[model samples]
Target: MAQAGTAKQPNILFITVDQMRFDCLSIAGHPIVETPNLDELARTGVRFDRAYTATPSCIPARAAIFTGQSPAHHGRTGYEDCVPWRYEETMPGELAKAGYHTQCVGKMHVYPARSLLGFHNVVMHDGYLHHNRMRHNVAAKDHFDQVDDYLVWLRQQVPSADLVDLGLDCNASTVARPWELPERLHPTNWVVSESIDFLRRRDPSKPFFLWMSFVRPHPPFDPPQAFLDLYKDAEIPEPPVGDWAMQEDPMQLGLNPVTDKGLVPKRRLKQAMAAYYALITHLDHQIGRFLQVLNEYGEMNNTIIIFTSDHGEMLGDHHMFRKAVPYEGSARIPFILNDPGNRLGLKRGAVRNEVIELRDIMPTVLDAAGARIPDAVDGRSILELARAGSASPDRQQDASLDSAVQGWRPHLHGEHAYGHLSNHWLTNGKEKYIWFSQTGQEQYFNLEKDPLELHNAVNDAEYADCIVHWRQQLIEELKAREEGYSDGEQLIAGIAPRSTLSFLKA
Candidate 1:
């Protein structure tokens, strides 16, 4: 007989979908995509509509999630075009030590994409897919242009020369679909297959922490024939602010390079959005299969299932096709948590509007699994929200938690190091402030009325006090991080370069 007090330790099924935006799901109210599995998952779990990625790119966002630290502190500034070889503390490292069988499959985007970080097993997958250093030549780069190892394996199935016409395109193609070509393989399918294989052979005695990541609905918009056909008659909604010519923001004005149509005409926007949604629907179908396997093995009831994306794809929103902007379309990411224990007595189907970030995920997972959370994990766990009705349960802490000054932090900060120098943001409650170092431009928005953030109130004299407060928040936050460093600690943490450390110490 199971003791009532002996807490049931739930297995964690952590799935990360690359570049999936917040509004891409059918349940999230996307007008085009048919995401049945994601919809179902949303129905049974908490949907964090306002969850933001601390950094909205590949390597930096991933490092933040794994290590539970802000990118400013992690030192993975941006997508550096190479593998990050640094051994940093990771969530799986704590879980693995605590006896969970940790495994990672698919695109982690962490340099190498093969770093164990903390996972006991890692099935290395795609790293740099969209980037091409070569100038285009008349000869089309054949089947294996990106993700070299994957293309090499595809060649073993058929002669490389035979699959030459099926060359991979890193950029989304409006002219053609690569499916008819023989060597093209969907990265999402490869991730799902790897996950299924691992689950098939997983030991039943020990619980598991599986980080199943998929790279799709990311770009190159190459969804298979079946999924594309499924959305043939579907109506894709025109975004509320699709026309860039009418926009006032300089960021919006400067993003003319993202569109496949060069200038985004309304008709082309609809077609492109439909194609992106089709890829999302296809990704959802694969997730459905993975979930089905868990259910068949009776692991569903004992698993703490989490589904989220690293960041978001603009999909032509704000006239930008890809991410790396401070707009809500690129900054906000989807976050969902479905713990079976919540099914019995805890609150299920909850929606949290409170602001959170990607860094919070590491501590949250560790809290649920009863794993040791390293002191280095700066983000606080949201397990309190599941264990108790509120994120902060005690009367004293709950008061503050429910009020804006609670739970692991009173305010959160974000930074984007690549692109135009950098953009740093800080927000608490309904007030948000952004600062771009390159342009020395500052913007402020009261999210209460201006959720879309169309109007910039930075120059307004009336809101000067509010701007000052948020600016202080950002400065104080950065200063706090700076204070955490010491001569000895900085050297051991590898924060100071070898040459600089020696000179400074001397």
Candidate 2:
């Protein structure tokens, strides 16, 4: 690895996907999905077994990734569109300042539709954002032609084509279908296509920071026919339905495609799962294509590749279909860091159990580039932990690394402002404690024993003390907040959720 002040810097390839569950990858011991390329990436580097998105949604999760700050610091605790992205320090901005040429290929999801945040240039395509697509009271600048680069290119290829032409609602619907257009024109393929183009056109004088963000496996569960066919005859497992989530009445089982929770028909659910897995497989293949191109450019060995998702999809886990819930299916994300040159002397294929989150990405990127992490940033680099394996006694000889590991928070506090489902949770990766703000309902899970969160052990005597400990930690975490969620003595429920906090709005 280049030293902090060295002239040569490593290239950063930051890849992000939308609403992909942590268990979707084959490397993660998933039963159905096959992700050979991702598996290879994990084997060549480190895969974090317990990584999470502090704010489990697109807008806020990405906010943490770019700013290296927690949800409280960033002031976006939930999913909301049209909020302006105003931050002085960002991962790309810091990298650009350190002389890295920065570029983003897909899905900025920032407001005004064209806000670059920090990249030198962005090829933007935030798929099916209702705020941008609204016909009424929409500005010309927010129009598709004005903001979406992929839409413009698609129009040139097929005059009448649009993202929603396949008749699937981006967020609300889980209906699955094969891509109607050629596989090359699919948005997933376009991301890689544009990224490869950037590699070809980039100036060779400076190292580059490229963000390849894919807006798939989110919804509209459409994979190309070839990818979809991979799961056509396969036996798909039913989504885990916790006793706590069981609905006695069949009528209560959601019939609407837009429902966020409630059981759907078995056949329909299976189809959705098949399509979702297919999309992941399709993305894996495209990533493989991009890796081949990067190697061809001779940049693969010298570059740092970090693959993660903004958040996870519920995929009917505990009868929840979307994100913003505090469950593992929605909050946990897949995080794999590949340093092909072994620049940091990291333990290859090591699976670290330390609880990490999206906030850590910025610091990690800056650390790899030998750039200065801003004082305002709240996240710490995981490089030391990667170097020493875990903070276990044998690996604590290095005083600095030991101090860093000891200072690591015992638990991560995560929340999302999703109205009735709005919740705050605390976890150290092995166990989780969740408190729903609206109802004050509590849930406790021993993730080591029940990875799928199939059983809620809140009322069990075995975990009572553990629950109390986590609850107090959450109180300390929220007491200083403007929302009055915690009064220092106890939690105060029934506070109306705010997607963007007061400071952010100002």
Candidate 3:
């Protein structure tokens, strides 16, 4: 194994996709979607089955991954755009300081649209951000031509092509359509093309940190026609509606394409599901292309690869569409770490059930790179646990097995600010407890028994003690916050939530 801060440090490739659900991968036993490349990646690495995103939205979730801080520490608890990314310690910044050349080929999702965030160079494309498009002037700093490198290349390839020419709203509409242009010109293909070019042009003397962020399966629900056909005949399961999620008037909210919670027509929902799954498979193929290039460059064995997403898409789960909800679909994400060189001695094909989150990404990458984790980072490295091998089979049935792995947090606390959907939750991978911040509604789910969370068991007398334990845990987590969600005794509802906290505003 190459020593840290040495010339032989392994290359790190950090891959992120937007709004991909945890159960979407066929390797994870999804009923419809096929992700052979991702399955292979997991087969050669460690897959954390219980990974989550605390904030469960693009901006705030990315903030945690980049800064290694919790949502409270980073102060972006919800989905708000245009907030400046002012963190001093970032994953790329620290890696750059340790003599690694850093490059990002896709979504940064940071302010100024072109902020490098310590990367030596960034080939940007943040996928039709309204904040950038709303500027009336074509020459505005945040305009597509000014910030999106892919748009510039697309125009050069096909002079009249535009991203919105297909007429799909990037975030609001759940409409499904195949790519109107040539498959090669699709944004997913473009991200991989640019990344391959980066690999060819990267500095050979220094170990590189490359972040390939894909902004797909998030919205517009458009995949290439061929990919869409891959799932046309497949049996796609309907979104599970929890007993607590039935709407009083399903049609009232379902008519609105942008509504967060609603019951859309069965056909429309199925079409959207097919398109979403198609986009994921398309992304998987593109990733395979990138991996082939890595092997061609002879860097496959000496590289450390990590795959995850900022958060997950609700995709009609519990009648919820889009993100910012503390439910399993919005908060849970797929996390896979592959160290082909065995530098960390991580057991191959180990499926760990640890309650990992995005904040842990920074430290894990840094630990693998032999770079110093910033003191400001609020996450712990999972290298030791990874080195400890997979948990024993009896571990799931017995709480006593937890002592075998040291330094693992007992549970994870996740939250989001989405008006009525706003909630705080605590989970240890087997069970979950949630408290709706706006309505004081409480829910409990035994994840081991019901992974889909089809039933809410908060009022069940059998788990009464479990509910109380998680409630107290959440109370302690929020007691120090300025919003006063808790009064040190119990949680207080109706406290208006802020997207970015006052400390960050200052």
Query: Which ranges in model 2 have alpha carbons more than 4 Å from their true place?
Result: 1-7, 138-141, 249-253, 390-404
lDDT of 3: 0.87
lDDT value for model 2: 0.88
Q: What TM-score quantifies how close candidate 2 is to the native fold?
A: 0.96
Give one digit per residue, the lDDT tens place, for model 3 in 407-506: 6888998888887868889999899999999899999999989888999999999999999899999999999999999999999999998888989878
Poorest 10 consecutive residues by lDDT, candidate 2: 390-399
How many residue pairs collide in each prediction?
Answer: 1, 0, 0
- Tell me the spans in candidate 3 whose CA falls farther than 4 Å from its real position: 1-5, 136-141, 247-251, 392-404
What clash pairs does model 1 have?
84-111
Candidate 2 clashes: the total is 0
RMSD per model, one decimal: 6.8, 2.2, 2.3
